[model samples]
Target chain A: ALAAPALAQANPEVRWRFQSSFPRNLDVLFGTAERIASRVAALTDNRFRISVFPAGEIVPGLQVLDAVQAGTIEAGHTASYWYIGKEPGFAFFTCMPFGLNTRQLTAWLRHGGGNQLGDQLFADYSIQAFPAGDTGAQMGGWFRNEIRSQQDVQGLKFRISGLAGQVFQRMGAAPTLIAPADIYPALERGTIDATEFTGPHDDERLGFFRVARFYYAPGWFEPAARLHMMTNKRAYDALPDAYKAAIQVACAEADSEMTSRYDHLNPIALRRLVAAGAQLRFFPREMMQAAWTANEALMADLAGQNPRFRALWDSYRPYRNELFQWFRVSENSYDNFAFPAAAAAAR
Target chain B: ALAAPALAQANPEVRWRFQSSFPRNLDVLFGTAERIASRVAALTDNRFRISVFPAGEIVPGLQVLDAVQAGTIEAGHTASYWYIGKEPGFAFFTCMPFGLNTRQLTAWLRHGGGNQLGDQLFADYSIQAFPAGDTGAQMGGWFRNEIRSQQDVQGLKFRISGLAGQVFQRMGAAPTLIAPADIYPALERGTIDATEFTGPHDDERLGFFRVARFYYAPGWFEPAARLHMMTNKRAYDALPDAYKAAIQVACAEADSEMTSRYDHLNPIALRRLVAAGAQLRFFPREMMQAAWTANEALMADLAGQNPRFRALWDSYRPYRNELFQWFRVSENSYDNFAFPAAAAAAR
Candidate 1:
């Protein structure tokens, strides 16, 4: 009880600017940046702080990685797959077509050597990335019309990002990368007939139901999309041990909190969206099969063209394979039984 | 860099003794306590430290809540369900028969006012609880003989903790609450016919496979078992604001880390166990359905007998039902497709 404030004599005041690739409208995505900054401030007793900027406040939405790498911002929060143009291997750090669920992805990152592979790629860019958040499984997208089969996908104009765009293109859909702020307008104007931008909570915020009535399930392209806090390596390495620990702890909290928020909010949001006339539908087997074929081919091409992609794929695919088998054992068995059972009980 | 080491001058040194309900052998469980302490020390610049004692060091394994409540230990790490004798509602905080999965439970805790409900329960005991860790879905248990139906479970002695014992008792199994340390001895000596400890990682460590070859899937009674850090409220309220923030951050890390540990370790451990001649079997639908019926009756009876149980159940059941409905949409679709695809492709 005799403790007095040491007045932070040993704690150097430090400040960093953080940019989010998401617009401020998406609270779960953009809010995670604020949460991380706030936790760091609290843990460090205000000696260390971070200021957050939404997309376009500094660099445009998709330029977060470039800004962080160039030290224009000390850190950036963005999805890893958005930088597949920089290196296809970057996709593994985020999510891949037919990849891990939320828990499986985090497990891989924390224990299955995922961070090492991701770090190896990030180091080349003068960046160190931490898995800061996840959006669980994204709804496939909102379509103006139902996608029934492979034929329906042909020549479809889709606003999609990451390597999923490449796979859609392979399946004969014309895919374009649109920033989050731009997706609603593109869909409304019919410039893009469909758009996939996170799940029900965010989609509801964007009022996608008003513009696109046909909502699809299972974003196969992004089963569990993870976001990263990309820090400028020089800036990160210079931090004291305690500051480093603060960032690690804060980022991990954001990592857990994001999905928790989505899980809590999405159900309520989905119900509202449905009430507002968003007709829910599942992608047909033929289309999913075609998309799967396309994804496989596109990934193979990426691996053949990019050595780093191959290296990450080598680490990621086998772990995914083995984890899937185990999940199908206990985790899957439980969910397959329990979710339906709960739903039925409520009925 | 004008900072001098002002830590000793400004910070008050504080220390606390912590106890774990788990033994040191279960690293993922007890190791979480150590991780929390380490993270706190690093964040607080070694000014605040907690020394951890394993179960039986201070009090027996199941006496952790009592120790924290009585201030015998400043803090304790244990599961909530172990103290169901005090309140059947505590089982909802840990897990329940046909309860939420790992993500669903955490989601409820974080966003669905689960923490408030739990805190209301703990406040009576002069304790504060924070969810610190999770072991995804547990495998049903290690059984000497396969449980093919309701008939197979009649008079079977099972070493299971929690209200699950009550549920099993309703299903005609004689269930005993045994500490983690005593479970192996009970199983080995034929004192218990079956035991459901955690999933593969802890079960494998305990050598349950050596004595019980018939391992079961889908731990229905505990789809996801969560652990908590229970701190004496008197001790917690006296901490510095920064110290409170440090513990919150560290516990969140452990919350995320525990599932990651299980997800990463379970797959490998499962493979090893199966290769060592362990038989993996799914609980027959007949048995699962019968167990569900038994669980429903037991829960209803508890709700009738205890107002607190009814209060917690009132909050939990609806959130779970709604979450399950939402999960069956995108999450189920993705996992149902991706997991099986990955497994088949591996073959």
Candidate 2:
């Protein structure tokens, strides 16, 4: 314990328990929690150790943030978007519908002062937060029936999480909050007409394609989803500087790992889902328009009610609008010509 | 499916089934497979889609190459190092003990003609391969007890995956093969005295710190572990040009996503781990030397036996040596002084 004495003299090791909102099945989210724990331990040399519990182990998955704030758990891994039920502004810390992609989200957090704003927001909840993982641009939820027009979305019962639900609900869909585990059964039993569970790999694993054959394209609701690691503010401030650095390094690493994993697995899983007789469908023009309008209205209401929401909306909306126009001009134009033609020639 | 008809006219929709040698639990590896499928689908519209299966669903986790070769699956995602058990030379394709980090491996593969060499070697197995994911440099392994001298490692049963197992075997440590799910239990039961799984995030999730208090540093065996996406040569070559292009683009995207994700998630995970009671332990001087020497011997054996391994060894060894010296002059020295004191102050 030669180094122990030195570590002890500098800072005392603190033991903590971290609860995760997602199950171990979603590696990016669950793995983020695991990654933070390891880095903190390494940096602090065992003086500080954190035990991680999967969603159901400590508290109900959805209640992780509340548990952390209440100090029932010292820390938590979840999406800031999940807390929108408590405050609509919380979604900005995670991501927004039809908003930034992974790169832009990171840029906003790291360079555009999003991190500072996020820290400030969490401070009110007695928590310290960091951007831990992003699921890039996600796909639209899977559907049991093909959505051919705006009318098709009316009265649709969909299982969607976070702020996306509010937007969908405004479009006249019954947006139900279903856990990832419960999604499969709900979709299977006709409890949900559509559901979104990340990209193809996860959707396929949960057998969404088995019961629901109509898979949709473009996850307009969750353009980029950011997962977070939140610690008790007091606990985080007590971390040794070395441990904090390690946590930073580890979170950065998690960002990379999560993106790469999604990039690789989503393709193969999509292919299988399609091959297994699941029909891939796209939202009609009218449907997309309606949803976007609904999303905007919901955001406006959220901002009107909360100052933090207003602050983030001021920055986020303009950035997204600018990005949307740019992507439409270049990426959309080039991809349309190159891909569809290429697909035809391949056949 | 309005877009599908146009896409079909340009390039026919092709479907592929990919089996992964990883569970979605290991996000980076499995996620790469997911990204490839999604990117290909987006590029080709609905014309090209690939479905993915986890390691155990179609076959055992480690037999990704066999499945690809047999054409039971069109493609697979796995670490090339996992196949060292089949051919000692395969380790260089994935990584070598004390070998290249992320940058060096990327340089070797993309610019240094390592990919060409990899293709030539995989040709014998009737496979086409691409670099899918990289876990940069890794931590050594979690040890149950502190390592004092070379003798401390002798006769120890260590659960290690990939080519590092060979190097440890040479050092008189009995290297055991344990699946990711099984690592914690193996370590807890004292069936293995040490184990390594990526960096902190993953190691922390497996709860290695709970049982093994002594966490070691510097993952010499896997400085950069690169995963590969392999396809049966015939299956790949038979694809239409457009499908081929889609696959290539998809692979490239997966490559980027895997690394980016790692960068994001690792930080917060580390801090949480530290607060959990895990102790960080560095390897003693003598043990490191023994392992390094053993690695050299293993490398020499592979070079002598496999021509492709020899080619890679010729190119990689020198590059690694040069990089090490460079890092020593820059990164290593700066980090050593900066980290410890900074860590102390933060504490």
Candidate 3:
């Protein structure tokens, strides 16, 4: 092992270009990729390098995953849900509405059967994926008006992406998939009635609060949103073992860092949003009920369509059910009574 | 707010019993007052309640941070650094060898701060504190190790806690820390060379880890660790605002679980010291010298004293004169080359 260092000492420089799904504006997500690129260069003694391109620089922001899939780029950073159009099952790889929280998701992916399952799923796409970042559960979307009942969503247009769009569509609302850059204009032009980005902090930073006054609670659509570093299968396959581990370790590091940034900043951002007159509202029971029904039906349809989805769902849903049962016995009971009153009163 | 029947109706009935610090055997440390009992009960519309007790009854194996902190037990969580006794800087809140991981400690206290931060910190503690618990930085503890060259750490006995311990003590030989119940036997049996208990994790688990692992991390002391809750503090504080936000919200949940339990656990056990096998070693010169003499010294020392710690060091570290300049450039460059070696090879 010691001689390994001496043997590797004489390697030439390798450089690759990478793109990000997020703009530099959303620091952590974008920063994670930047950090990995940074750490890689540092750890390799300057022998390997990655130059990152933020959203929209090399290709359209939303096209990063495709770029990696098409081998247009060697690697890229993105969220799986972004490509749900490619396959609804992809949503499970990124996040699930009202699904597992961060730790549970990580456990499933790392220690549980998730990683192997995920790689198998991505095999057809000719890409390899790693769990790089998580946003925990997110805040619900931002809306221009207070949603008093399910009727409020009857014909609303929302800038939501991935499988969640199907859920909204089921509620009789139209789901519009728009890139982050196009969101502000669309919402401003009344093209969409609502949009869910992240928590108050990112929303405020993007000035969504300026246009939308009603901020919903419990980002049920993304109970735990994960980001991935998708690499072209061929390109990725070409690297030495150490580089792969570096990517894995670096991705884990970034995953940890990104969540930390969100945890630290979200509180302040929520406070700021509230102070700025952003009215926070929990989804109405009727809405939650309706969404749940739609979500269940969508999943059923998905399972019927793909064997992979069926297999993954068989493993995934049961775990979620178990977690829910446990949390219901403890987490929910406590949170339901405590947070609403406490959080509201705190302000 | 009081007239909102919907809110009251939504509250559930919950009671959860949390255990910690003490062995199921050592009742006081583990059983004392079931910290989150009232809060868990309150959160669940009174349908849920938790009665916390010592570790033996539920999980006598090791600390229950993740089980409870992740809401596994509703609450069995405990002190932050009892594990740190294993890792260095891990003792920042729970306890440290030489110093504190304090403020950076708390900043990293939640999901966003650092890897060790957040609910997972308590996940090991066995409960979810969520903003409900915290402990300030802690004192470095008694160690069996003596000071000498870095090599002296080789074969020395230690019973430290957390990740830092692994990084530091692991570099050489003989870094170990066991639970309170096991510590006495190990020490009496000469199984451990050194140990660290929280000023409290040990007190409750009882002095063996501390008694045997006497020597502490130099300069780092705690490196400023921040202790916190090992429960659903969010759940607990979710009660009426009166108790929720009024709580300090600073105790770094895991350490809170650790401290109270250590205090509770440490009292009853009798220890028969093992002879000869244990030789206390202070961190050797090269290690301490490396920390003090390298940029780490300037950074750690400045962080220790500064309120901002380099405007919280996140920003400043990158900006400081040539401090990380090489890694800033060369490190990332090299790592990008070398880091992907494994991923590429696997493909």
Candidate 4:
């Protein structure tokens, strides 16, 4: 029950600019930023408000980290892997090719050793990072043609990013990086034969189905892509403890809510894509096996070349392996048996 | 950044007694209540504080809802299915036999109309409920002997609860409901041949592995058990909007953190169990298939008898079906391909 207290000093109102890496149209991804901002404001009784800006408004999407580092904005929401060019270890914070799924990644970051390792790395850039959202297990990509074997991957031009790009390269395919806005045009103009983006909801909005008739899954490249909210270190440190806790709470809420939104909307959008004649196909077994091989080799190479990458990899790989073991016993077993039965019953 | 401001009107200070359904020894489950209380206090700058009381402190574990409904406590943290005697529909809010996993359940509750349905049913008891924690995809019960086929279940005496009890009963097994504290002794004394509790972390604490060497999984009976933080409707409504928002933010944080903690701790505990000579086994295919049949039949029977249960079932079943379809293409596909490879490499 509420009891009136002696008058106290008012907490100062604070406002922040939060730049999002995703465009305004990709609501599920970009909207996570809005949700965090509003929830923070609500929890703080409007004393702390954040104004969200989509890509290219304040700065380009890919430059969010730089903006946050330079205090161009007080905070920014973007995936950590996009800055892999800066450090190979950055990819682990987002997603790796065939890395941990959404829940595993969340556990590692929140409970396992991931957050400490992440903060240590992010501190170098003068930023404090928090996981804000996740796009659970992405679709492989939309393909102009069905891939039947490893030979189908040879010399095929693809638009992909992160370590997955390197895996593709090892498979003798030409991998190119393209911004989300440009992916559709590249596919449409035959510049790229295949491209991976977010899952059904955002993919449908970009009209990838109209351009590429074959929608392939599952996206081994970025199994579960996590978005991060990075605040300028000085700005973050200056906040009162209550406001700091509010930010953490807001980010956790957004992280959970965004994944649920994707899980709910992806099914509906997928149905629409199928109705519109987008053929759904699984990546061929041979292709998957070959990609797995390439991923293993590439990870080995990176670990040998960069000690920092090796440090993170040593911790990440084992944690991931343990998670894989546990999931096999629990999640994978139940899902493998029950899901197919449910599908057959629905049919 | 924070700045000084002139003194303003004092906000009301509110306090609530938050009762937990779990004993203090079961830290992971009961600890969620403490986390929520502290986070809410932190977010509200100590203006709103909730003091958590463990099971049997203010009232017995199973009487949480009754306490909240009778206004004996302002709030409670417990499982909805624990009160299934009040309404079968309450089972859906917690979990069901062969039901949705944690992520799917979270999606349904947050985004796929489940929250509204849950609130509508909870309104009858003058309670407002929010999901506070989840033990993600529990392991199957520890068994004294290996189950190799459907025939093995025919005369088994099992300790289980909720709809799962009925399913076991239909399988020709003698099913009994026992309190958590009593399960270890019951199994040790040969009163029950087997029992399903939460999972490895909690199971190890209860020393189930000592009594039963054959640890079978996955727990189809209760895939993901969600704990609820229920507030008395009058008390909840009377709170200032900011405090209400604080409660919500606190609950969401607790929900995410608990599952992450379980995912992290279970693996360590499982490894410890295995080292101590526990033989981990998968439920035989024949046993799983039979239990699935029993689950379906029992669900149909409940829906046929209760309109409210039917209403929630109609919605939950379809949402689950759609989620299954999506997971089949995304999570299941990736896991099936990758987990085995990871396992082989680890070996």
- The most accurate candidate by DockQ is 1
The better-scoring model by DockQ among 1 and 4 is 1
Q: Candidate 1, residues A91-117: lDDT per residue as tens digits?
A: 888898888788889988888889988
Candidate order (DockQ): 1, 4, 3, 2
- Measured over the true interface residues after superposition, the C-alpha RMSD of each candidate is 2.9, 23.9, 24.9, 2.7
TM-score of 2: 0.51
Judging by lDDT, tell me the better candidate of 2 and 3. 2
Residue-by-residue lDDT tens digits, candidate 3, A55-86: 88898877888899899888899988877777
Residue B99, model 3: lDDT of: 25
Which candidate, 1 or 2, would have the higher lDDT against the true structure? 1
Q: What is the TM-score of chain B alone in each candidate?
A: 0.96, 0.90, 0.52, 0.96
Candidate 1 at A170: error in angstroms? 1.1
Give the residue spans of candidate 1 off by over 4 A: A1-9, B1-10
Residue A323 C-alpha lDDT in model 3: 40
Docking class of 1: medium
The estimated TM-scores of all candidates read 0.97, 0.51, 0.56, 0.97
User: Which 10 residues in a row give candidate 2 chain A its minimum summed lDDT?
Assistant: A1-10
DockQ of candidate 3 against the true complex? 0.03
Q: Say which docking band candidate 4 falls in.
A: medium
Per-residue alpha-carbon lDDT of candidate 4 for residues B63-142, written as tens digits (9 for 90 to 100)? 99999999999999999988888898999988987789999999999988999999999999999999989999998889
- State the TM-score of candidate 2 restricted to chain B: 0.90
Q: Rate the local accuracy (lDDT) of all candidates.
A: 0.89, 0.70, 0.56, 0.90
